[model samples]
Target: MASETDLGHALPASLSRPVLLSAVGRVMKSARAAAFTAEEQNSPLALRAYDLRHAAVSTWLAAGTPPPLVAKWAGHSVQVLLTVYAHAVDGQEDAARMRIERALADDDEAA
Candidate 1:
């Protein structure tokens, strides 16, 4: 069951799946017509509403959100979330090195 906040009101599971999918298709078509560029309309951008969820999950992971917290939000186990989103969490080598350096510096200061 969807929460009230999910769609501004709870979407009863009793709603037909076909009806929901049809509605999403209609919305996608209209949004594409209004907002998409010529090339974007031809491409698979926002091809399905599920793509938005995928983007959100990827963005959260890349933004340094904790894997456990992101997994909870995405309704996946930590292991599954890491497996799926590991590719999206790239370009952090410099940040990782800085963190390691800081930890070592702190340790040396304490000694």
Candidate 2:
């Protein structure tokens, strides 16, 4: 992990504390107002930041990141990770079902 100092040089002299604070204040104000707006308030985006998180996790899972690592990154228990993301987990049972059925059909043909 890169420390703050390692990530980049120190802020220039022109980037003062008051300037940073003012910019942060404006962003917070805008975010607060957006949070309360009816469109944002009732929309799925506002209702479930978790869905976005889920999508990210699903992508990570599909990309072959190990379950334990993904769970740790997601701040979820392994059990909870499995329960919530079963559909996205690799080696799904439903995929096996079709293969099993085909094997049975092949056996019937042999019989």
Candidate 3:
């Protein structure tokens, strides 16, 4: 039998696709996601194995990974990456408002 371990990667290099899917299924069966609604348990939700890739991409983007690099890693065109992952980038409105307030306060102090 071939070696299954992959150095530096959580997924083994030789893990069969079916086994990988089964592993994800086992985790989902035990995770809180198992309690989710039928709609919430559908594809593109965390219940599916593919959702891990979505989470990974979204996480990298949320952690400030550059768009071009993310696109490259995701094997997508920059435009497609931006369009698809836009929903992953959230919660900037409050930060922007605070920055504007700070800038205005600094201007008032200068004046």
**Candidate 2 to truth, TM:** 0.41
Q: CA lDDT, every prediction?
A: 0.84, 0.69, 0.73
lDDT of 2 by residue, 1-111 (tens): 222233255665555334464666566556646667766645555234445678999888766667888888888888898888877866755756777899999999999
Best by lDDT: 1
Worst 10 residues of 2 by lDDT: 1-10
Clashing pairs in 2: none
Tens-digit lDDT track for model 1 on 11-85? 566662346688888998899989999899999988898888999999998878889888888989999998988
lDDT of 3 by residue, 1-111 (tens): 344433233554456345666876788766635577767656455756567788999988877677888888888898998899997667656756787899999999999
RMSD of every candidate to native, in Å, equals 4.9, 10.0, 7.1
Q: What TM-score do all the candidates reach, one by one? A: 0.71, 0.41, 0.47
Give candidate 2 regions above 4 Å deviation.
1-47, 90-111
Arranged by lDDT with the best first, the candidates are 1, 3, 2
Report clash pairs, candidate 1: none
Select the stronger candidate by TM-score from 2 and 3.
3
